[model samples]
Target chain A: MIDAKHLTKTYGTKTAVDDLTFTVRPGQVTGFLGPNGAGKSTTMRMILGLDAPTSGTVTVAGQPYRDHPRPLQVVGALLEARAIHTSRTAYHHLLALATTHGIGAERVRQVLEQVGLTEVASKRAGGFSLGMGQRLGIATALLADPETLILDEPVNGLDPEGIRWIRDLLKGFAAEGRTVLVSSHLMSEMAVTAEHVLVLGRGRLLADLPMSELLAQAASDVVLVRTPGADELGKALAGIGATVSRTDVDALEVTGPSAGRIGDLARDLGISIHGLVPKQVSLEEAFMDMTRDDVEFHASAGSAA
Target chain B: MSALETQAGATVPAPRAAPAGPAGPARLAVRSHPVSTRRVLLSEWVKFRSLRSTAWTLLAAVVLMIGIGWLAGWGSNDSWAELSPQEQATFSPVDITLAGYYLAQLAVSVLGVLLVTGEYATGMVRATFAAVPRRLPVLWAKAALFAGVTFTLMLLAALLSFVGGQQLLGEHSATLGEAGSVRGIVGVACYLTVVGVLAVALGFLIRSTAGGVATMCGLLLVLPTLGLLLPSSWQEHVLPYLPSNAGAAFFSAAPSADSLSATAGAAVLGGWLLVTGVAAAVTLTRRDV
Candidate 1:
């Protein structure tokens, strides 16, 4: 388990992570969601004790990470940046880290096989492709079979198959009662992989809840009513305290009422309703809505178009 | 094996024996032990030997020391007959035999700087520190490993150069039993070892490879030359205290008039090592990796 309280990190006058307090429990995957420059990497660094927090404390497995007798056995982290020396081969890189905790070379070979890097284990890491580099990073993280695993942007350069494999791997880790915290900017990926999420924006906790609750919150009740007499139905719906906007000549998008109620009202109004479809809000759109005001860089609408 | 075949056929790069099922934690059979100084030293040894740069740099240092010492001996012998009485009187065979250290120090110091700066350049320090989060052990281990290797190999080089160069010197050769000859031979190796440690400290203080190399060269080579522009009185007081100048006093068979004694020179070099080492330790434990 990982627990952080009042965590804050600042450089000069710019604050990266501010007042973050949360607990990542075992037996489930927690997704750390944030846009670029939103301090996900910095927070992870603090948790690993690679960076000292400007204020507050973060601990893994009941104490600060540095205090653990065997930190590799307690927590294994794959940082966002490639941490392996480019000049060393994959095998040697793993061996060097493993030797610190007296972990044997057999364990090194096991992780290499687990990450499917056994074929290129002898090759220098400088020559590996982006996907291969990510594989090596994962292999290093899994070297000690720690109780908690923290990976930053593990899917950044993975193919679809690799992405699926990582999803299964994380789920399996959680299923085995280990704490897994994975960070990603893409909410769609998290929709399938994460059971709980902690969203950050402008270095503040924007949302900390279960995935099911977040999806349900994003699920809107707006229904689309298509009828030849859309104008008449729109006036009747607006009079009953429902907001109605004409999307097309014969379609009325009605909010604040269910599809059944809207259909019943249309029949009561003597309008010939051809279709009534409720729009399903995607988690991507919901994420955009939640973080729209907190996004650091706003691409102009015209430029995006 | 069937799973591997199917994965290869399907072009899925990662395929395990089975997906880590919920049967139990994906635990390996490896035993865990606390990180100790010995294990960290072993880890550093692995790191030091794994790089091609380490072997190449050490090789260059050994070849330059022994090869150039032999060449200097041959050159001095060829010019011995043409030398004036005064020039011939001041000539020391021990100095000619150890002349290779002048060039060999560059190779040793560069390797020292690269040993630390290389990790920063490649982002590997993060992994290194994460594994051994106390952080100071790594600094000490690197210094220990580099010093050990450099002293052993350079001592061998010094001995080989002394024997070979003395052979070339013919009748002008100085034996190991001669006064100050043994000290000069062993002192040269100690001088190079301390130089390597200074470079290692600078590598940690300045984490960039270029900056570390430039600063190391500036202190060991450029600063001494720049001191030559000073007035004679000031030069005696100042030039003798510089790193290279102080290091040269103990390793020279005949201590120069303005330089410190052999014991004092070693103390001065130790002073340099102590100051830089403390500063490096402070910054390393305090700074964000």
Candidate 2:
């Protein structure tokens, strides 16, 4: 388990992580959701003891990361994809890290194979493509088979296959009772992979909720209704306390009432109902609604387009 | 055999593995054991050898040492023989062993600086600190690793330069077993290693690859060259403290009038190394990784 209490980090006059208090429990994948420059990297760095926290403490298994006897064996992290010397071969890079913990060369070979990097283990990392480099980074993180894994943007440059592979690998890892914290800006990906989520906006926690609860608490689930007599249908739906939005001359997007109920109401009013379709709430829409007021840099470009 | 063994396996309990930390059933054991310096040294040794740059730099330093000594032996024969009796009187066989020390020192110092500063330059220092989060162990390991490799290479370079210089000198040369000659060669090697370590310490303090290299080169080469341009009084007062000047004293069979006494140079070099080492340790421990 990883725990942080009142953790804060600041650079000059700007705060990067403000009063972050959360526990990342084992046996599940916790998705850290945030936009770019929203403190995910800073928090990870602090946990690794790469950066000093301005205030508060963070610990892994009740001991600070710096104090852990065997850090690599306890916590495996990939905070940056290219956090290695570009000139070194993948095998040598992992070997160096493995040697630090008195781990044998066999473990390095196993992880290289585990990450599907054995074929390119002898190649210089600088020559690898971005996706390939990310694979090497993941291999280094798994070198010691640590109990906890923290990945930052692991799927940023991966192919569809690689993405699915990571999802399955993370699921399997968590199933073995290890803590996995994956950070991403993509809501759709996190919605499917994350069992629990910690959402951040403007360097502060906006919501810490389960994935199922987040998907369920979407603003409203709408149903599209097409009717021949829209005025009469609107009156009937309004009378039943259903909110309706006009889409066209004969279509209305109705919320707060089920499709079946709306159809019965229209029939009772003698209005011909043509279309009644339920609108599924996408995770992107739900995420936007949850973080709408807290987004640090709202995409004004979207509105302009 | 299998039937009876399988029956025993089903009835008898297997030895359970040791429990891990309370984070729950961890796939890997939580190594809560205390860290030892041996582990740190092993880690550093692996880090040093894994990089191709380390090999290249060491190769360059050895080549520079042997190449410069051979060239000086062949080219300076006439100059040595043609020297006035007064100048010829000052020549020593040990000087030939160290003919390449000045040039090779530059490469060795660069190696030392790059040892630590490359991590800082590429932001790989973060990865290093994460691996050894106490931070001091990383610095200590780096210093020990650099010192160990440099000392080995410097000793080899000294031996090669001496043998090759004697081959060029022919009848004029002295052997390693000659009185005081062995001390001179070993002393030169020791001096070079000390200067290299000083560069490593400076690299940690500066934390920039180019800046550390520049500072080391300036200290090892530039300061002594500038000392030549100064008046004899100022030169005598300042030259002993310069790394290069003090180091050259170790190669000389007899101390020059303007240079520090051989014993004095040893003391001064020790002082310089001590100050640099302490500053490096303090800065590394106190600063953010």
At residue B59, give the lDDT of candidate 1. 99
Residue range B30-77, candidate 2, lDDT tens digits? 233345567777867877887888898889888988888877776656
Model 1, first chain, TM-score of 0.96
Q: Compute the lDDT for candidate 2.
A: 0.79
> Model 1 misses residue B187 by how many Å?
0.9
**Interface Cα RMSD, each model:** 3.7, 12.0
TM-score of each: 0.95, 0.87
Which residue segments of model 2 deviate by more than 4 Å?
A231-245, A254-265, A298-305, B1-35, B84-86, B121-123, B170-180, B226-236, B254-256
> Per-residue lDDT tens digits of candidate 2, residues A1-305?
99999999988998889999999999999999987777988888888888889999999988999888888878888878888777777888887777777777887877777666666777777777667777778887877778899999999777666687678778777877889999998998998889999998767887888888887876356999888888888877888898988889999998889988988887777888888899877778777776776666667876521
What DockQ results do all the predictions give, each relative to the true complex? 0.54, 0.23
